[model samples]
Target: MTSAAPHQSILDKPFVLDLFAGPGGLDVAGHSLDIPSLGIEWDRSACLTRYAAGLDTLHADVSAVRRDAFESLPPEINVLAGGPPCQTYSVAGKGAGRKALEEVKAYIERLMAGDSDETIDRDLKKLSDPRTAMVLEPLRYAIQATRSHNRQKRPYDVIVLEQVPAVEALWHHYAKVLETTGLPDGTKYEVVVDVLDTETYGVPQTRSRAVLIARRQGLGQPFLPEPTHLAYEAKDWNRRAERATSGVHQPTLDAEASAPEAAGPPKTDGVVLKPWKSMGEVLAAPVGTHPGRRTPFLVRSNYGSSGIPGRRGVRTDQQPAATVTGRISRFVVFEHLDERVVREGARFSMNEAGMLQSFPPDYPWSGTAQAQQVGNAVPPVFGAHLLSAALGLPTPDPEDLRKPWQPATVEHRAKLRSHGCGAGDACTARCPRPEDQAPARSSAVPRKKASVR
Candidate 1:
């Protein structure tokens, strides 16, 4: 938990190359921690967003970028960080895991050779699917391609891989590859896998991601950040329960509650289980009075379950929001309306959704459709925490960061408490029904009945 000095400046700091950088969330966090960074992204709008954030961005596919290009740069890059595309490994997508590997393999081959001509194109095209292989394959190649440099006494100090929990299995291969290289097995690299929620890091949302931290030789073991904010159930105060019982509050239950009684919580805490950020905190005013000023279809869908039109219907003063997702279908959907009020005819806007993900208010996203950009972003606050930890900087003060973006009301705890439940008592409201609780009747009258017969 190293803290940065007040006079410290990120300008001219150690360099980082952000691969597959989306909307520059990682870059933003890195810069906040005083780490200088550049990004490589294929999406035009994402490039614009990065540029607006004052980041040096390359508008090209990461796989197409060669190691020489990086080698040629004046500054020495200390780290390589990015979350490669996860569609192949995502459960929502067809499980084309192996195909995804080939795609990365082809990209790595081209990058290593510094060639992206017909041969590379042909190889890339040969892969019919990209969902079967581990999403980190390209990263593996990037590291190996750069390994020769390590032998020359210069190597990347760290590589951070962010992805869905499903990608954890891929780290073994990455570890093995790092070992094979001449870098000392334990000294050269280490892998850290853990669940991180944006809320804990002071983001308004409760998005949890599986973060993998791998450090090159000579650097200290990459830090796994401590939880800054606990989930509703795990919070020190019973704030979650208070809000839930209050008429003014409506908390989004985790996705597990949707399952049948017998089915247990998902083995992996799916993103749905995380708390949610409110819509009002995130949405911006419509661009103009005209219909064109209204929000897009997908952005409106984020609030569908609340039965409130236009507004995300989030109650402020609650825990941060759940993890933001790309598809509206994953969570309950909301209706679109024109006004900001949670009225019948109001609509939801894309800007609001982006705020929930903790992107800066001024982030420049130049896409016609807002959902695509919003879906691709990682919450900037979450990224900032990780970046700070990695650089051995101090954690941001909780008060200085955004408070949990949940709906809140000023009600006494006693007013919200259940009638039969006490401070230490188990919840009786969820207990078995009265009839089920009755003891079974005994059958000791058999002899008397026989005599009577």
Candidate 2:
């Protein structure tokens, strides 16, 4: 596996264009690896936050790109990536997408069958939730890139996407369509789809996403990133967390566990693969803080199967976090075994919440509904691993994520700020994000199943 292109020099880095990019999670990861990337997001708050973090961004609806609103896109961009909205398809929420699953698959078949955009749009208008149709949006770009008629005679070298696990079946359909598609030059794509656990890739959350990567054929076989951190059984995590909540010291992993990976054994490019990271790792008091002053606490989630204002779920600081959703404000913390403390900063700060998603501690989060952006982001740590694996490049050392966002080969984000929005009058136009005009407090997340594993 290598980053060298088939026809280009070994030193040329591929450029990336990400669609529906929420707060630049993948962009952060791309920048960390020194790969140039630009994210197109419609949400004003998310775009503002991305700008504050010095990430390159286009604050516009992805649909606009379809209408040729962006004509100056660089021809050098050979990688297309995005994670479209998944609320309609999410099992944890309304079943509009789930109920229309077969309809969605039929749409993919129709799309690949050369159905016109007008035809697809006309039929899509019949769906209960308009967002359900957005699931097929990524394919529009992918298919166009492969066409010889487009100005760019060459196809994108790689295409990547991710969404909630409920979208796994849809991604499989994508893989099938992509592999079978061929351009006049006999160029086709090879695709792979997998349900990836964020924790397995060293993310502090247990979120799972259905990811698809389609590499233009003849660019070597594509593969998913090997898991670095071992998976922890939910029961074990709960038991260990119980002990920690009761004042017992809970180590990262079981010291006496028989499993080699559980023991933090070395593997994967000879780097020592470690146990899954815990909330304590990111949530622990800063280095200069007095250790004795930081007391033990557990996060209590107010939203769950028991319903809001009913039975809540709790996770200890010693364990990885339960999935952090867009409604992150629902999770609160209390004194260990006491619910009434209401301590200062007990509710996670924006930085703490972002860190839980493997974002840099100082990743400048700006604008309204910042929590929604953090919750919606793909953890940058895991994003780097996925991109590295798909691009046939070296997977980075996960241990190095602890320090401030500095990586040995990474350039400062300030150098890329030129791609951000223009100032003054030029930025006057509000991004066309009609769907994002909702009250920040009313943000919704797909209902997730209790993560026992």
Candidate 3:
């Protein structure tokens, strides 16, 4: 697939705009590939963390921003990636899918009609649902950008969006909207949407997200990412963890017995993929502090004395972790010490949660907000694979994993101070840098580029 337009070489690299950017998860993935990335976040704490990481950020609510605001961007935006706030669509949340879809459509129509703020605010307040319609904001930007710029000079080349699985239907609706509605030149978009599991991308967590990739007509066909890691199975785990985690009846192994029969693997992308990374292998330390042979924890949300139906708790060290949610504080961890297991209370720290999400260990995290951000973030490792697919770059080297955890660098802190921001002002309004022009893609990436099948 090749570009349909002619002209500048500046658009060679993707210029990423991560809306609803949380703690720079997607941006970090983009940065690792040497792609110039900018984030738009409304949360003060998230913006603080982004700035501390030396990332370019704009602390503004995405719903309030106008499409014209992006006109100042340097390189033509090749990729517009975002994971809108997903509370309303998440299973852990209200699961208000039908209502959310309707509201979003209505909101978009109102916006297109140039509805007054007072009228919009009245309607929004009456619904009392701030997050449901938030998903439409990105589509609004996409529609406007494509309309303003002709096909030969499109504003954006690719659109990448992610959300909880429950939003898949909405995404399908969105794809229809983009496909049926042609641009000013009667050009339609090529769209693909599917749900992807994080573990399949080698992340240590079993988080699944709905992904959408849309290419403006003539930018080649839209492609979906394929799994780079092995699917999780009971037999493909460390012995101790396997015995502790697997729910299927596992045959006891004699010390001298031959290995169990291995299942034939499925082929994808014409490559033999590596096994999924387990929580035990990633942590290296025992998980689940409660007394038992288990070393990993099966955490759930809002499971208290209420006796929820889907509240079966299990333990293991062999498999990937359950989806990391905002209520990570409620996850209990047990420790195995000596010959006995002890109640370690909440076993995971913010850093641990971030690590499970494939964030660098030394990634600077701040306070309670850090936990929420980490839990909601798209794992950077998974992000790397998707962004690489978008850029037609080869998959990232498995050896190039998350960086070791460490405190913020003096240079990072100094840059924060230069903007008059400090540790104390992590939740305050601070200065914002002007429009960022990303540098050329670094040569660190592998030279072998491949397209998705």
Best candidate (score: TM-score)? 2
Report the lDDT tens digits of candidate 3 across residue range 20-77. 8878889888877788887787666676677667777766667555433555444466
Question: What lDDT is reached at residue 327 by model 2?
Answer: 59
Worst 10 residues of 3 by lDDT: 444-453
Taken over the whole model, the C-alpha lDDT of each candidate is 0.47, 0.68, 0.60
Q: What's the number of clashes in each of the models? A: 38, 1, 10
- Candidate 2's residue-wise lDDT over 379-424, tens digit each? 8898888788778767666555555553221233333333444342
Local accuracy of candidate 1 as per-residue lDDT tens digits, 1-453: 222233222223557777767777787666555567777665655554554455666655454454334444434676667776665554334546644544564454343444534564555455554323225334543444454453343556667777655555555445544544433222346556665555655566545566776666456556565555434322222234335546333332322331222254322223223233334333423322212222321132233223444444232222333445554223332334222445443333454455666665435555443456676676677777766666555664433223222211223212212211222222343322334321211100111110100
My TM-score estimates for the predictions, one after another, are 0.60, 0.82, 0.74
Query: What TM-score does model 2 achieve against the real structure?
Result: 0.82
Higher-ranked by TM-score: 1 or 2: 2
**Rank order by TM-score, top first?**
2, 3, 1
Stretches of candidate 1 exceeding 4 Å from the true structure:
1-12, 92-95, 98-126, 130-153, 179-187, 233-319, 327-342, 345-348, 397-453
